[model samples]
Target: MGVGDVKRRIAEILREVTDEVWARVAWVAVDLTKELIRTGRRKIAVLADDVFQAIGLHKAVAYVKGLLGLIEYPPRSVDVVVAVVATSEGLTRREIGRHRWASHRPIWNMPRDGFIQLYGQIPGGKPPFEEVWRATGGNSKLLGELYKAGWSAEKALREIADERKITAFVKTLRDEERELLRRAVDDPDVLFTREDIPLMERLADLNLIVDALPERDPWFWAGEPPPERDPELGIGRHIAWQTPLHREAVRRALGG
Candidate 1:
């Protein structure tokens, strides 16, 4: 079906469930959010924040417009706000993104799980899904970068290592950050130390690294004293290369 057809279908379905009450009035509010998400073109958190604002403005509009028209304001918009309010209260971004509110939102189509779930979605996804998951850490932007590589570990690594954007980003890095990347060339999971704190923050700002988990340290180190989880090393939050390809790319750029 065409996009218009899909939208009409959704509107019809909602109309049926709206019981001719306030829900019809809510159509505009939801449309506002859909437009912002489609046009604002932001990350998940920023999108969610915008959705919150859109819903608020929608509420004020519905109230004033209804008062002016001498019509009873709909209660359905309140239901929508309930969803956004829940997010503001404490819901994780993933949890909020999974709400029914996203039935027509593009966030659902984003690479939340990367190839772990999308390997079957796209044709010719030959590389192991596990490898892609490890390499990109489910980061949508990074996954887009490697999409042309078509799922081979070697190809993904090669693409990252040769990607112009990757090289340009590396060139912008400081010598200390480059040194960190060179060290992670083969040791992507190296536990960041207190000493590497500044460098880790610098790399994370560029999406080259991500917070991992303590369990990823090593089984052999099980008997060793667990390193103190310090905020400096992002303790309680494991730190590592966002993608193995990123590690290799930076490493190669540093002439490791």
Candidate 2:
């Protein structure tokens, strides 16, 4: 059946339920509808049946409520969004959306107003501004922690590195992975290719390294500037330590 018909049917089934139960069911239905739209799925009937069969109506309602209760409230969401903006200052709204943790909500949807500020414009887009998301002075400590090193380049490095965390991370790496990290530490200016993506991605997942564009001019933020390209690094993204402290921590962990 069509999505509308499926919703009508579900509503009919839920009609006898109290307003509280109906509200809970409606909340889940909205989330499910969004997921279906996002995935371009058409089998609404199948989803409806599965939802009913997998968990009875009563239990499903309770489950969703439980999950909602577990979710930390608003400012936590604001913190995550701000942290991302702080670390990656030059990202466009579209680029920020690529981060899995960043919700579909607007960047300004924060507990405290004026948490983020735009710096300059980027050419050729609806939101023409590069939407350089920078945390205001209030979030300076967080900003410092995420983007500690370098003036011009958008280094995804953390300002402070916890040695114990680094040690634990090292223990989890395979010998080859450890060796690769050692190479990164030994050659901070190391260049990587497509062949290195898998390893680089692993390190990125561990928050040790990040793949980013080459450094921009320190003044680039002051005005609209053409994108910078590093011929030596070619067109591919460059890999760098997540933080200078991370590099130092890794060096110590690797016995450098």
Best-performing candidate as measured by lDDT: 1
Q: Which residue pairs show backbone clashes in model 2? A: 122-130, 157-242, 157-243, 158-243
On the 0 to 100 scale, the lDDT of residue 248 in model 1 is 62
lDDT of 2 by residue, 141-179 (tens): 333333333232233322233523666777887898777
Candidate 1 C-alpha lDDT tens digits along 43-133: 2111123332334432433432332222122222222222222122111323343434332221111233433565567565366766655
TM-score of 2: 0.34
Output the number of the TM-score-best candidate: 1
Q: In order, what lDDT does every prediction score? A: 0.46, 0.41
RMSD in angstroms, candidate 2?
16.2
Candidate 2 least-lDDT 10 residues: 77-86
Query: Model 1 Cα displacement at 112 (Å)?
Result: 12
How well does each candidate superpose onto the true structure, as a TM-score?
0.41, 0.34
